[model samples]
Target: MRILLIEDDPRLNEALCCALRQEGYEVDACLNGQEGLYYMETGTADLVLLDRMLPGLSGEELLQTRRKAGDTTPVLMLTAMGTLADRVTGLDLGADDYLVKPFAMEELMARIRSLSRRGGGFHVDSGELAWGDLTLAELSCQLRGPGGECTLSRRECGLLCALLRHPRQTLGRSQLLLSVWGPDTEVEDGNLDNYIFFLRKRLKSLNSRAAIQTVRGVGYRLTMQSEDSL
Candidate 1:
């Protein structure tokens, strides 16, 4: 399926693009709402992962604009937590789903899967990921951890998906950046740091005993922790 990722954070954009590509899915991405809308206008994306607080043309406005123009493509809105009210407003504006920031990749994948199942897009996922109580249905893009549920932004989903595939191997910052973001992109290393912070927060919230360990001065690890009850 062709996926459009609309996120401003360079680290997030790069990681998501790279990870999705590795999964063999056709993906096109944008840094802001304007670029995202332009792509949507082209009718090239099967689904869109749109950030709510964008620079120009916020995600909410973008979705409403598309719908006003009679475009009904599936859209998943991304916002930081504490913005559930914002999500409801966005949904009223025409978004199909909403995901908060500090979310797991698996959760993001699950939401996409849910969208795909409804939209009937051609999916190309491997479905081989599991971390602690979390499970990733790669081909389906769904995540589950105990009873708590969360959907991932495309960027967050790809970051975690890549880490899950790598397990305890210490992926270097450069390697991770290249792997997640295509090598041709002009993103900087600082971007990777931001995503690591985002992923860590998400995992901690889902399960405090979960493992997405950072190797000082290096990259990270997404290993299974046995002590947790969940």
Candidate 2:
């Protein structure tokens, strides 16, 4: 899972980032709320750990702005204010959970796991993306199929997510490229083809009937093939 850690204290930020990384999570650490806001705007992070007191923008202001802009990524507010009123205010401003400072790392990790399972605000109802018998766990980057389960690389996960979001539809090359790679990325067409090849191989290994079929001049479509066809 990708996490954004926004904390002003240098020691605390470094410690938290190191701990989270050790636990196998990709973390982006920032010292203030402005940087945190910028990262949040990218819509890349799965969860955010925001400190209440900040330099550029306060944590409350940052959360309010994100909520107003319709960014629904799960947020866990971290602060020294442990009073009832403070917790109420944070929750009212759209924070999914709140944690006070001087907390145990174990408890923090537990909360993160719980929040990830609950998914982000956009996917609170269904955390796992599914099609047919194939299931993709976004937070863990694990794909489960008829054969078994396997972990997917970052690019592979992104590609599968894009295709799964519009299953059975032919997503054009440009659209897939922009979604998998970034809009500003200058990548060769062959790179996308390579990933497609990898995904097909992965599906076969998983014994999945789902196939990634390429259109003559268009992009690709994900569909379930009949037993006779396979």
Candidate 3:
């Protein structure tokens, strides 16, 4: 899961980022509302943890602007103003959920999971994804075949998940870099290609015939063109 956390407080931001990563979610954070809006305009985030009070543009305004622009990425408003009217206004502004500040990490995770899964809490695993003999367990994040289970590192899992999500679509190198390593990481350039190589080797071990096709002067694609769209 990729999440954008728009919080200006350094302490809260640090806590949220650390905790969410521990739970295996990729997070990009911004210290101000303008930065948050900038990230939203530039990156693909599965959800947004927006603080209601922010400089430059308030969270309410940000949500309104995103809705006005037809961006439906889920937004969960996190604020200190815990009141019925506050919650009501947040929902009116198109927030998917509202969490008061000084909230429990477990509650935040639960809410985040609920928002990502649309309230039922199921992780929404799709039907089996196959690239030749290589198969991905969408729900389990496993790479396996008739032989047995093949282990995948954290980065490898992230890469394969992304490729499977957008099968046959050429994901740009920068996009992959940003997704695998969060915006704040100091990863050297070309790290994405290295991870791709690792992912390809793991796939091969599972007899995957799907190629991570590289486009000269561009990026890579998981070429499973023969398969139907999910």
Best by lDDT: 2
In model 1, the runs with Cα more than 4 Å from the true position are: 120-230
Q: 38-129 in candidate 1: lDDT tens per residue?
A: 99999988888888888978887888889999888888887784466776788898989888775654456667777877744456344557
How well does each candidate superpose onto the true structure, as a TM-score?
0.56, 0.53, 0.53
In candidate 1, how many Å is residue 135 off?
14
Where does model 2 exceed 4 Å of error?
A: 121-230
Ranking by lDDT: 2, 3, 1
Q: Residue 147 deviation, candidate 3, in Å?
A: 30
- Model 2 clash pairs? none
- Lowest summed lDDT across 10 adjacent residues in model 1 is found at 119-128
lDDT of model 1 at position 155: 58
Q: Model 2, poorest ten-residue lDDT window?
A: 119-128
Predicted candidate 2 versus true structure: per-residue lDDT over 1-230, tens digit per residue: 78999999997787777667645578999998889999999998989999989997999999999999988889999999999999999999999999987675545765787887775542333447899879998657799999999999877877887788778999888767655554335689999899999999999999999999999799999999999986
Instruction: Please report the candidate that would top TM-score against the real structure.
Output: 1
Candidate 1 matches the true fold with a TM-score of 0.56
Candidate-wise lDDT, in order? 0.74, 0.83, 0.75
